[model samples]
Target: MTEPADIPSPERVLDAGALRALAHPLRVRMYDILSQFGPQTASSLAQLTGESSGATSYHLRALAKHDLIREVAGRGSARERWWERPRGSVSFTNPAVMKTPSGRAATQVIMSEFLNRRHQQLMRYVGDSIKTPEDLYDAAAVISSTTIRVTEEQARELAEQLTKVLSDASDRFRDQEGEGVVPFSLRVDLFPLPPESN
Candidate 1:
């Protein structure tokens, strides 16, 4: 039997080193802020994160070391550096990283931090949904949950198909620069639930 060919993906998979570097709570928060708000200077991030400029600068350099974020070209100065999160999704589904206790712990930290941020975003959206502008709300607001039974392989297939759809749409509009353009997080969660206890 032949092995399946490795298919290219738009998402960047995080290795153990990158995962370890990003496992810190503050680093994760900074990365999320950069992603959500686009390029920012260390001073700006310091204000947003409520951390000192020195601290944010230190963490920013750490994130840059792993290529998770990069300094914006020709932006800011020696005292302040403009940093931005690179485009594309970051996947934390590295199997090898989960083989050891340390790797697993790091993975847990990153995942937990992201989940907390996402939950806060969801709650804020819900709170503002009623008062949000009709046009913007109608175009973007969606909160959905659906349950379906499927085999493991089938689940993987579904996820791949869904990912492709999102990737294509993202690529098409990724560079849109004009009025009404704004940063939006497109998130999808697909996983199996545990069996119910009697």
Candidate 2:
């Protein structure tokens, strides 16, 4: 399918090489920071991650080698370079990637880590929610779910609708240049739960 010019693109299906490059927890953390805050230097990431600048530089180069991230042109001097992801996000949507045993394993590892990170962030917010402005506390808090019988088609449709709404909202606010804006994370997971008796 052709990618549209305006909207944020769906994640490119990862090849084995790209998946392997991005499989590290620290590297994925670097990617997350870049996604949230735009261009950053390896040293800055190193400070946030508590790694040496040298190590962060090494990982950043690996990410660039696989084209998952790239160096921002003319952004820094000889000692430091800026890095950013061309696409703000990515996914392992290609069937080919999962067809290989290593690819499947790596994909699962990354996906699990991503979800685990999300849950951690959610917990952090919950802890801090009480201290936040009341308006933000009221308007920005929600965590509710339910279980109901649904055909496969119905489930797929519901997921798609939710995704479309989130995508539209993201498109409206992406790449802002104005001040007083905060970076927010949105997590939407939809999968059948284990049987009630299990």
Candidate 3:
């Protein structure tokens, strides 16, 4: 799964087999940690997840076997290897695969966990708003949605444009170390508006 240096960040389209491998809770959480924090050793992730290093290492290997993540080269010795997310982002883009029995079950579990995590994050902000520093709190977040008309092609175009913009911004500023720079989270989803009927 090594990508060419000339390619911008690589996006993975996970099939049913890969999805099944990633359906575990710890694996999903480990993937998020690696993405947000950059490369990490299994020991480091284990410290974060309260699992033993051996357990986290096994999970990391499993994730690597499916190409959801990979070893970070030259960062660690054979005794302690480092791991990271593969390039840009990953998606479940194929509906034909997702419609299969195993694929549908895995998709449902992952999506439910994803939504649940988002809910927990929002709740943490509201619950801890009083304790959070005022400046950080003010700069924290916004969640909004809008419905619009769009055909399949138009929707695809919009998704492509949005991904390009986000990718550009991420690549430009990712390594610029400046004072007070902290990782920020962004999510954008584009899909057809469900039919309106009463």
By lDDT, the best candidate is: 1
> Per-prediction TM-score, please?
0.86, 0.87, 0.79
State in Å the error of residue 185, model 3: 0.5
Candidate 3 regions with alpha-carbon error over 4 angstroms: 1-7, 136-141, 145-158, 175-178, 190-198
TM-score of 2: 0.87
Evaluate candidate 3 by giving its C-alpha RMSD to the native, one decimal. Answer: 3.3
Better of 1 and 3 by lDDT: 1
lDDT by residue (tens digit), candidate 2, 35-67: 777789988998888999999999999999998
How many angstroms is residue 164 displaced in model 1 relative to the true structure, after the best TM-score fit?
0.9
Clashes of each: 0, 0, 0
Top model number, TM-score: 2
**TM-score, prediction 1:** 0.86
Q: After the best TM-score superposition of candidate 2, give how far the Cα of residue 69 lies from its true spot, in angstroms.
A: 0.5
